[model samples]
Target: MMTDSADEKPTETVAERGMWGNFRRWLGRGEDDLQDRLFALDDAIAHHPSTAINYVLRGECYLQIGYNQLAERDFEQALELGRSALARSAWGFGAQVAQDRAVRGLRIARRR
Candidate 1:
């Protein structure tokens, strides 16, 4: 028989924790490596379309690489997928007015 304890914590596998490690490493890599990592993240996103966090992560990478348009797109998609406050803040919009402006910007971009 097995017993469960309230103080026991669930364990995360290396694969589950690798994203952050990879992200940290990517931050210090050159442009080419960053691009390669971004491509890999895109592939991961393709396989996991419903994961909002993946979109946000990819958006961060895009922003770092000076791809503002793509980053905005990903942030907008993340917001649509219910990312809400985090996504808005990540795009540098923490206040309600800023969030509204972001929404308008997204709408304008979509219309073009």
Candidate 2:
């Protein structure tokens, strides 16, 4: 019978503080150079291994640095993660977007 507003905010913010939080925070840090961005993304993935965007970003960093093979590996892994039930639960509504990003990355990676 307790209708307290104090308990409502946390239920809504769970996604924000989890996978979505890290991904959105990374995007909010605009104009960071590739190396710094890559390092941050690596750390993010180390903690949130199921987050698809981190994989995509790391793959992009590898691609930009002429490491096409590593880029391809990450891209492939991103796609796999995108399709997983665990990752999908974390993604919530962004699941399709994550898959789309991985597919696009793969296309670019395959051109080499």
Candidate 3:
């Protein structure tokens, strides 16, 4: 999640609620700008395919912008990566979060 205050300074400090806020701001912005952010996230995912945070963020963005197919793909990828991370660690919180995001994503995707 992220935020932009009255001064319009972007801040990446928000709980789950901020996800919607971020989505709204992105949606209201220009399409090219939003796509750039998406591409940046995509690049990050490509470099760190197993990162749960990156996957969740990208998937969430896609879902927000009505790209359910892409969202599903990101979510599924996140789930696989999360499971792998979970297996490789004794206590992996990020992996657990990613797994949960994937399940939620499936529910969101059901409408598509």
lDDT of 2 by residue, 21-79 (tens): 65565564344566666766787887778877778888877777788888888988888
- Give the number of the best model, judged by TM-score: 2
lDDT of 3 by residue, 46-104 (tens): 65666776777778778778999988888888888888899999999878987998889
lDDT string, candidate 1, 30-100, tens digits: 76677766866676677667555556667667666667788788768766654454454655433344345
Candidate 3, residue 82: how far the Cα is off, in Å: 0.6
CA RMSD of all predictions: 10.6, 9.4, 8.0
Candidate 3 whole-model C-alpha lDDT, 0 to 1: 0.72
C-alpha-based local distance difference test score of model 1: 0.60
Where does the lowest 10-residue lDDT sum fall in candidate 1? 92-101
Model 1, stretches more than 4 Å misplaced?
1-32, 83-112
Question: Could you tell me the C-alpha RMSD of candidate 3 in Å?
Answer: 8.0
Indicate the residue-level lDDT of 31 in model 2: 49
The lDDT of model 2 is 0.72
- In angstroms, the error of model 3 at 40 is 2.0
Instruction: TM-score for candidate 2, please give it.
Output: 0.66
C-alpha positional error of residue 81 in candidate 3 after TM-score superposition, expressed in Å? 0.6
